[model samples]
Target chain A: MERVPILKIGDILLVSIQVDMSDQTAVQLQEDLAERIVATGCHGVIIDITALDIVDSFVGRMLSTIASISKVLDAETVVVGMRPAVAITLVELGLSLNGIRTALNVERGMELIAAHTDEREFAFDDEPDTETTASS
Target chain B: MERVPILKIGDILLVSIQVDMSDQTAVQLQEDLAERIVATGCHGVIIDITALDIVDSFVGRMLSTIASISKVLDAETVVVGMRPAVAITLVELGLSLNGIRTALNVERGMELIAAHTDEREFAFDDEPDTETTASS
Candidate 1:
């Protein structure tokens, strides 16, 4: 079975799905990601699907499952680089893949994750950032 | 103090901000929204910001805070009708409004919420929709 490669960039885990995903492969990727998130303590997971030419209901559910798993483990998942056709197909199929966050590209995915992490920190500490306060 | 009105449409709550939001007004809106969500048991919130011509970091944070509060109360928040210039200003201010979901208009926002609500029901029930399964 072919396995997806997960790359770690700083505190984010990046996974680019370049191959056609089988049921077994998708399950493997899910397991691998959960482990990677725990071992690396990464707060973000970016799934790049630019290379994927198509997606079906099964694939949509797989993405949603991975996202739910990551959320349970205290990590945010951002699906990026979805082709227009794939998006249209998903909508037509009635698989919204809800509870999943998406971005236009990996850069925006990182930005979203970074902003989320900042918000989490802001919630814990009542003090505003010195730079922002000074500017205001 | 100007109070934002939350209208209940179906199972969704809609809030359109047309007046200038002061600090106290923003806080009041937040409190009122939380109360409405609980009282009405609405599963979705649509915040229409189309009337506001400009937005600052404080408004950005208020939006974020409301989204977070809605999430905690088991409701989804979709911000709609944000203008282009407002989006640019938000980015310039370094306020990403990260966790809040956005849509182009009220219709799209409602669609997003509906899709999300469908996904939740799908999650709890393993059986796929009869229509979709039959068609597939």
Candidate 2:
């Protein structure tokens, strides 16, 4: 249980973590992840937490901070696999991660990344071909 | 254009890839990640997609599959960083990732892991020594 698994595929990384409602370990984990993210040069981060049944303001705030910090590092972040119950809990608890980005599941998250990548590439490709010469 | 920049944290590999939505790319990434997770023996997988603006049934299915694959490889996956707009879009689209795990952000994702770790540690630590048995 002391192990946190994170997998990197291309530019994206996958992470899975467990949680309990009545403890401070969640806070510690947040700080540890923030530090790890800053240390690693991954372009994107995904957090999957389907195990959590309830979330409070403190948990919500930590998540917001992590997202903010990830952005500061120039990496995009997404949340996936949210249960309706947890979503309702968060809303009822008056905890909202307004600016944080999230997806329903991992596939959507990947699509987001693909969209961004495609956009960037399209933008670059659309630039006039400086090396190509056309016969007038 | 194929890179999924989920979150960029200065350097560390926070949760990178979660679910793959790009037809072939998604499958490839999922396979690659499964292999890596099995080889490296990591415990948590975070899939963040703050960039996705849409979620379709295909993507939802893919996400669930990835979660299952990750679990088989002995790694837990947590989808993190969901956006409200996207969530609403998914609901409107009638897409659901019913059996997947998720977190709101990296902080919660990490907290989830930490809490699990603490639970195990406490469970073991709280065990009374046979020589010094105490009544609760």
Candidate 3:
């Protein structure tokens, strides 16, 4: 089975799905990504889908699954470079892609993840209960 | 102190900020929103900023804080009706508003939150381990 390549750039893991994703390929990618995130301790994951000409419900579910997995591992996932047709098709298919963050391109995805990481770190450095701060 | 009025429409809570958000007002709004969320058990919050002409760093932070509070209470926050100028200014001021969802208008915001709420409920109805389902 063909496997998706995962690249590490800075503190972010970059995965560009250039090949048609078979079910087995998607499963392998998830396992590989989980391990990569733990080994590298990366705080960001950017999935570039620009090369994908078609995205069916299965692919949409895979993206959402990847995002949820990364979230559980304390990493943010951003799906970038979705073609317009793919987006339309996902909408038509009623796959809302809930809980997944998206960006127009890879650069913006990096920026989004970086900004979020900084904000989360800053929040941590402050009082543990942010609600108290707001109340005060 | 001027208070922001929160209206309940169906299963969603809507708050339209027409006046300037003073520190005290912001604090009060947060308290009110938290209480309302608990009392009403609403799963979605739509904050309409259509009337506001300016959004400074403080306002930006207030929005993020509100979103966090809502999330903790098991509700989703969607800020809608952000004027173009306000968006540009927010970008210039470097307030990324991380974790807070946005929509072009209140109608779209409602749809976004509705879709997400349904997805969550559906996920709950299925196997709790969604990751397992995806892998299979």
Candidate 4:
């Protein structure tokens, strides 16, 4: 039972699925990723699936579930590096994986998360950074 | 100068781009759809692109633009029937079509819009329908 490695880069969690997924493995990964999100306090999760050539319904569902659950845990999820063949197969299987964000690769995924994080940070800075001690 | 056709089904507007899109067509479709959204006062929009084998940056941008504009017009948009190759190319081109809703086909697209429409309708219903509300 090999576990998918989740690397933490700043406030982001990077998950690269380099092996084929069994139904059980997909389920286990979902649970593990959720737990990791809670433990790491990561604000973003990027799943790199460049090596995967196929995405069955089970795996597609798992990806969608991971994304929605991560959001509930206060993190955004980006699925990256989905090959054309895999994407084609998934679409043909009638699984659009709706509501899940995606990117071309891990680099774009990181940029996407970083942009989101920056936006959130600015959300709390309604009072501009016009610093002037006390009564300047 | 060819224009994409938009048909109305109930309260949903259906636009199926059946031809290969030139950049101008993509731009024009966006404008036409935004105008139609305002005119029809529709609750939902479904875009069918199953006939397309490729999705370039311009087309991808149009899809996103249509979704956002529809949102601003109080209509929800769902892009349906994206071919696998198109999706794969989109991901590779770094166009994730962010913030756009998608479904596998026209049937599912309708269901997605219907679900959204129903939710909004029930939003004003203070009490839940325990009796199934006209079960007869």
Candidate 5:
């Protein structure tokens, strides 16, 4: 597994990792990541791991732990870019990530956040527009 | 599409979503996620979307964004539970998440992190054991 690389865009953080789906390196990366999340005050996070062959129980648990820690620090996390074979194996293995947020790719993950921000703006605009109409 | 659910285990938070590949909900979800990431200081993230039938460019883009944000927050993120069909479609569409961390399932993601923590402990133990042997 390669070392995880982190980049930032605006308030969002991007983490790129090359993980061997069947190795211990993946676990180490998670711990390192958790520490970073705490250190950085940025709220958004994106994880890109397109290179993986399999997934096991240990990896899943670590991810959950990371998410929990992030919440304590007031940051949000998202996972993106996964291979299909690995996905199937995970389900067949009965590995349930019941509460994790996931997207097909990183692009989609970003979109999710963008939309939310846009919606808030729209809602705010709507209130002002309605007020103008009422005043007129 | 059903709303994505945020799961909490101990101090860990998992964000899980079920996507409909044919619809635009996935994209919307991505945008929404970005906002949440910014608002919540949770770096550890898990995305489980195994129900998608197809993955397109928009979805791919969102995933990329999610990964990017994670990096900014210095958090760890993992994509889990993708279907084979969706995976093929993403690749066929030339959608690539060149730098992201991904897993087959939630469990495996946890394992990856656990293994790393374990390795660190082992290394520390080894140092002490080595000293003991030298003295003997």
Candidate 6:
């Protein structure tokens, strides 16, 4: 089983999926990410997939699953650097990746996470009922 | 030369692309949407593309152009109802439709626009530099 490394930068977790993903590798990543999020108590997660040329359904679901798991641990997930071809292919595979946030590159993703972390904390504290979410 | 209707939902502009888009139509939309955005003083735009089965580069660029136009006027655009197949085909066609916000359905998309409009106004007042953008 291949392991995906989860690096912590400041209070954020950075994950760049650089290899061709297998079902086993993806599953291992899901488990590993959950453990990492719990241990690190990170505020956000940014997964860069710039190196991946092809993304099948399994890999797409893995991305969605990772985002879901990260949310459970009180972290926001932003998948970045998705090639145009890969995105088109993923949608064709019947995975629109709804409910997941994405950015063009790592830099943009970092900005996104940084901009939200504070607002999220404020929303959670000040107005739980009128919490504003940027989900589409 | 068919005209796409831009209906006003309060201060939000709702546009549903219900016909197959030709180059001219797409171009016309870019112009018409901008004018409407400025005229109505709307804070957000929701574009429903569920009726579009195939999105070529021209249409893809049109969507991107519309998003850009909205932003210039201080308005946010959320595209919704991207079918599974259309998403796959567009990416294969080499059009990623980056920098545009997307939603699973029209209802969810409207919610996105409404939520952001309120938050955006406050952010502009509080911290102009930290505008929370949800782009892919």
Candidate 5 residue runs with Cα over 4 Å from true position: A21-28, A115-136, B1-136
Q: What is the descending lDDT order?
A: 3, 1, 6, 4, 2, 5
Report the C-alpha lDDT of model 1 over B52-87, residue by residue, as the tens digit. Answer: 677888888899999999988989999988889999
Q: Output the lDDT of residue B20, model 3.
A: 71
Lowest lDDT 10-mer window, candidate 6 chain B?
B127-136
Query: lDDT tens string, model 6, A1-136?
Result: 4455565556777666655687788888888878878997887898877657777777777888888888878788998878899888887877787557999866678788888886776777887754555322
> How does candidate 1 fare on TM-score?
0.46
lDDT of each structure? 0.81, 0.60, 0.82, 0.75, 0.58, 0.76
lDDT of 2 by residue, A31-67 (tens): 6666666677766777766545556676677667767
Cα deviation of B73, candidate 4, in Å:
0.4
* Candidate 1 structure quality by residue, lDDT tens digits, A26-58: 999999999999998999998877657777878
Q: How big is the positional error of residue A87 in model 6, measured in Å on the Cα after superposition?
A: 2.1
Task: Give lDDT tens digits, candidate 6, residues B102-125.
Answer: 988656776788788767778788
Residues A1-136 of candidate 4 have per-residue lDDT tens digits of 5556454555777666755677777778889889989998999998877656777887788888899899889888999878899888887888898768888866688788888776666654644443222112
**Cα displacement (Å) at residue B67, model 6:** 42
Error of 4 at A67 (Å): 47
Q: Write the per-residue lDDT of candidate 3 for residues A57-114, one digit (tens) a residue.
A: 8988999999989988989999987889989988888889877899987678889898
DockQ of 3: 0.01
Q: Write the per-residue lDDT of candidate 5 for residues B10-113, one digit (tens) a residue.
A: 22235554333334665555555566666665555666555445557766666667666765664456777677887887788788865456778666766654
List model 5 lDDT by residue over A1-136, tens digit each: 3344354444556664443333466566666666666666666676654544556777666566656665566556677766688788879999875445677766677776566445545756778565333322
lDDT (10s digit) by residue, model 2, range B1-86: 14332332221124444233568767676766676576656666667665455556776777788778866665556677667887
Please identify which of the two predictions, 3 or 5, would achieve the higher DockQ against the true structure: 5
DockQ of model 1, rounded to 2 decimals: 0.01
Which CAPRI level is candidate 1?
incorrect
Candidate 3: the clashing residue pairs are none
Candidate 2 vs candidate 3, TM-score winner: 3
